[model samples]
Target: MSKKGKSRKKPRLPEEQDLDTFEFRPTGLNLKWTKDLITVFDGYRIHRCYDLTFIERAIGEGQMPRSFVDQWRFIRTILHRFAAVSPKIPGVMEKYKRRQVVRFVTLVLLTIAVPLMVATFVFSITAIAP
Candidate 1:
């Protein structure tokens, strides 16, 4: 094929190119969320310390039969569960949740509205044509 007839491929811009290596650099929002989560966990730990102390005393007194390994495992499990369901961080998580909901609703509306608009435009044009 002649060079003139051959289709030239467009060169990709830097922004259009796919990244080869992905490094997780947390954004300001993510850092804020992390700080809030840590704060909540710290507060939760402070409140639960007395319960933990009581449990430890019970085990030491032979009232609750639990091995050291079992006790550690139990504590770890409780902390993990708490972290998973930690109450919504007052501003950070609540805002994130609301944004997600708004985004979803917007996408759903656009998905329905765009096709309807296009169909209406096409029908109107056909009606106007001879």
Candidate 2:
């Protein structure tokens, strides 16, 4: 295959995510949730403060997770088991809760809907040209 047939490099996002702006400190109240999150994400090598912050960023702020959609999905998958318990995880509530709705909707739009739309647009253009 010709080199042109292969995809070019992806562009860097204009503004790099300021992950430094956030911090996640596990506490006495939410200790169980934090431990459970670690257990659920086992083998992903989540070991540092930054790792927790990244997950928090993804779920709470609607920012993209760093190449860990599989783990992210797993984290979300167990939500039914953990989300409604006594003390909620700090990251997945209010800004990222079913109660708020807006954050979740925006996440869906950015991750799923926009990508689909872009693919359709590209397909339509190529189909029309040829």
Candidate 3:
């Protein structure tokens, strides 16, 4: 318990870290795509792009692919489709935003409800058991 026996550790700065261990390398295309995607979401007033559920909902209508490869393909397809068109077209952007909002809200409600239903079923069964 003596103060002399205690050692304080200092946090390491980014410059102090080893460069070889840093793995993230964003290519120009990747950076551009990220920027473009952010812009699209901003236009739609959707700011939860970092959320996994939001991303899945936005790209695949809340139905996520079973495998990583399929998920990547699905995402790439959606990104390409988004990049190919202008959301500024009259009525198109509004329709898309409305659809996305509905999908996201429905998915969120279902996510909350399914677990509650399962828990309620379990409790009911346990309560009825001798």
Report, for every candidate in turn, its global Cα lDDT versus the true structure.
0.55, 0.51, 0.55
Looking at model 1, the pairs that clash are: none
Candidate 2 residue spans exceeding 4 A from truth: 1-100
Worst 10 residues of 2 by lDDT: 43-52
- Cα deviation of 4, candidate 2, in Å: 68
- Give the per-residue lDDT of model 2 (tens digit) for 14-120: 34233355233333324555665666445333321223464566457544434444244434434433434424556545543565687777887799988899999
The global Cα lDDT (0 to 1) of model 1 is: 0.55
How do the residues 76-125 of candidate 3 rate in per-residue lDDT, one tens digit apiece?
44444455465545787788889999999999999999999999999999
Cα-based lDDT at residue 66, candidate 2:
40
Please write out the lDDT profile of model 1 over residues 1-130, one tens digit for every residue: 4576777888532332223452323233345544643564476665332234543454467654334324344344455556555454557678768999999999999999999999999999999999
Q: Over the full model, what C-alpha lDDT does candidate 2 score relative to the true structure?
A: 0.51
Clashes of 2: 0
> What is the C-alpha RMSD, rounded to one decimal, of candidate 2?
21.7
Alpha carbon lDDT at 34, candidate 3: 59
After superposition, which runs of candidate 3 have C-alpha atoms over 4 Å from their true positions? 1-88
Error of 2 at 27 (Å): 39
